[model samples]
Target: MFNITQWSLKHWLAAALLVFFALFPLSGDLFYTSLLNRMIVMAIAVASLNLILGYGGMISLGHAAFIGIGAYSVGIPAYYDIYNGWLHLALALIGCGLFAFVTGAISLRTRGVHFIMITMAFSQMAFFAFVSIEEYGGDDGLVVNGRSEFFPFGDIENNVTLYYVSFIVLVAVLYLVYRLVNSRFGGVIQGAKANERRMRAIGHNTYKYQLTCYVISGMMCGLAGALMANFSNFISPDMMGWVRSGELIFMVILGGSGTLFGPLFGTGLYLLLEEFLSRSALYTFVTENIAFLNDAQPWVYWQLPFGILLILVVLYARGGVDGFLSRWGSKNG
Candidate 1:
């Protein structure tokens, strides 16, 4: 639990946001409710990446593979009528942990570009492996007939129930990451990131610490993937595609990789930008009003602006969105 005594501007704002989300379903807007669910799930996934990229100092281009594994963990079972929530979650955790362990063991042996490529290579291997299996619809993917069931406790019958469940998971994941990053294990990780030679000389066994961190991050992302599978009721290889992995990286960097609330805020802003450029009235305004350039579809070029903005952040912002917020958010604190 977070101490109120340490609450700053962003913390209070996050609390307010959570309160609003808690009460939001009462309004009964199904579209936005579902949208918020995606934001929460994406935030969870990105937060897992933060643990590796921000604190663990490892850059991975294949993190989405865990999410895919997690999704398939749910989807494959549902195909055969196994909807027990515990079973689904357990598979997600175990499958991702195993995958992470194998990949991290090999990837950690290298550093720089070699490390990034190996991790991605392993993720692509998983992607193709799933794609080759015809039992689960091959590249077409699998469908979940029903949401995961928890039996005596409850089941995700409605989007609202899933919404709250996902939100709670997000909070739990954040707490877990917060604790891990502040612990001695986290110290070793960041230390290795700073000076691997020094950490190794001090008897840290940096490789072991990093592999553990890698596995932890993968398991967390797997949880998000399970929730995502339940939410969308579908799973495809594209869910673990390299493009999606890149998006996860974008969100982490955009949100500030090492900061606690960065992923949450970053995912929110990313989705908001998607909404504005792709489905919002702003697109309508551009398509409907502009005189000589009416043929121009500004939404199609959405990434142009986003790419420019990201470049600015990379060049200018120290800690991404979190750093920018801290400047103005902690005046009184």
Candidate 2:
């Protein structure tokens, strides 16, 4: 039995968020619900990346490749008419873990810009591999005709049901990460991140620790990928693109890399801004008010504002939104 007496404000806030998410579906707006579902999935993916980039001090620009692997794990099996949810998820976790093990073995040997370039190269290789799979729609992508079967629970076709499932997984992952970061192994990895030379001098096998962390992160992201495939009911090579990897990195940084809930905040904020900018009335206003802009799509420039926001976050909130909030809280307290 877990004791509730030791729970702090952070724990309470997490509970409140879960409660809010649980009830959000009652609003009955399918569009918003769908957006929230994507946000939850992206939150998991970004958090997994944060595990390596923030805690382990490993920079991987190919993280999305593992996600793409996971997506294909589901898509490929389902292409053969296999639709078991458990099986798809297991395949995703195992496949991504193996891929991470191999890639991490090679990539972890390098550091700095070389490491970044190597990861990006691996990701590009993965992207090309997926594109070469002509039977699976190749560059066009594959559509899942039906949702994965969960036996007693059935398939997750219901938007509300899917939302709850995603929310539960997100909460579980957050808790798992929180516990992992406080464990002895986590301490060793964090120490290695701070100074690998010192860790090695003290008898720690820094490479092994980092590799283990990388694999764990990959598996976690793989799970997110499985969820994403189900959520979108599609898988494409684009999922493995370097652009997606960059977005994941940005989400982790924007949310405050080292914080447990930072990735969630960052994912939600980034996606929300993207959605708003792409669909907002401001785009219509710009096209209507400016004659020269009428011929071009105004929404295409949504990145302009998003890029500006990113710059502002980097300049002022170096620790990300989470860090800024923490500072504000401490100051007021």
Candidate 3:
């Protein structure tokens, strides 16, 4: 849909990454492919949060609850011997939209830290609610018996098939969000973020715009959750934990909160950094070599470096990774 001449560096990078991933499965490296698959799923979740947080300025910390809902839609259904892919997806979307509608209506009434705290409280409510359900494994978690099946030819049990499906979903989400942020509804949401009182003064129902945006965001995140459950073959209260929400927030901000494709970059960066820190032999060697770190577990201190990087980004780069890339062109990705 985009013209080549108008494309920026970030645009080119996005295209290149897509090409890479499309061909990555052909290499037959299951480990990295699965890792990238997980990245694809998290990227979708991050993008959903970006819709409300970046454009609508909702700053919700409860988005992970929606993800949990989507996962449970799949897990619970599978528990009852229902393995229909379309049904799971339908449930995920419906559940997330309903929860977002009810919660968003109430949460939107507040502002600033109150909004964040209230959302977090709601997320914890969902987390514990699931934890209390022993029949579904509760705190231990629920297992997905099999991958979803959409058609006779559509089998998600194969990693390659799932990767392509996730990739297509990622592309569709990007295009949909791009169209949304540039549309009339997007303008109203952004306008509300800028000045709600003025938007209301001009006859716009700011609350409606924000709540609708929130619901749409939740639905999209629920889709990601469905994919995630398929990928991990498991679901738990931990998926809805506030910490996961915080991590999603970190990804959005790190990649450029308000811009297109920011979530992809942010999530990719966050996961890659975590992967490195979590399994880096270099860290082990350095820690063992350095006397001061000899007694310290190398993996235990990954956050120190990560925290410092985040601080640096916050201090020096307001637009995040995508924003930094935007500097190369007049267009924002």
Error at 213, model 2, angstroms: 0.5
What are the Cα lDDT values of the candidates? 0.89, 0.87, 0.91
**Candidate 3 residue-wise lDDT, 1-333, digit = tens:** 389987788888878888887799899999999999999999999999999998889999988998899999989999998989999999999999999999999999999999999999999999999999999998999889898889766769888899999999988898889999999999999999999899999999888889999999999999999999999999999999999999999999999998888998899989999988756776667777889888886667777777887899878877999888877555534
TM-score, each model? Answer: 0.93, 0.94, 0.94
> What is the C-alpha lDDT profile of model 2 across 1-333, one tens digit per residue?
036776544445556666777788999999988999899999999989999998888989999998899998889989999999889989999999998999999999999899899999999999999999999999999998776788878888787888888888888888888888899889987998899899999899999989999999999999899888889999999999999999999999999997887887789889989998777787667767888877886666778778998999989998887787777756755
Q: Is candidate 1 or candidate 3 better by lDDT?
A: 3
What's the CA RMSD of model 3 in angstroms? 2.2
Model 1 bad stretches (over 4 Å): 280-282, 285-300, 330-333
- Write model 1 residue lDDT over 159-188, tens digit each, in one string: 999999999999999999989889999999
RMSD of each: 2.3, 2.1, 2.2
Number of backbone collisions per candidate: 0, 0, 0
Residue 196 lDDT, candidate 1, scale 0-100: 95
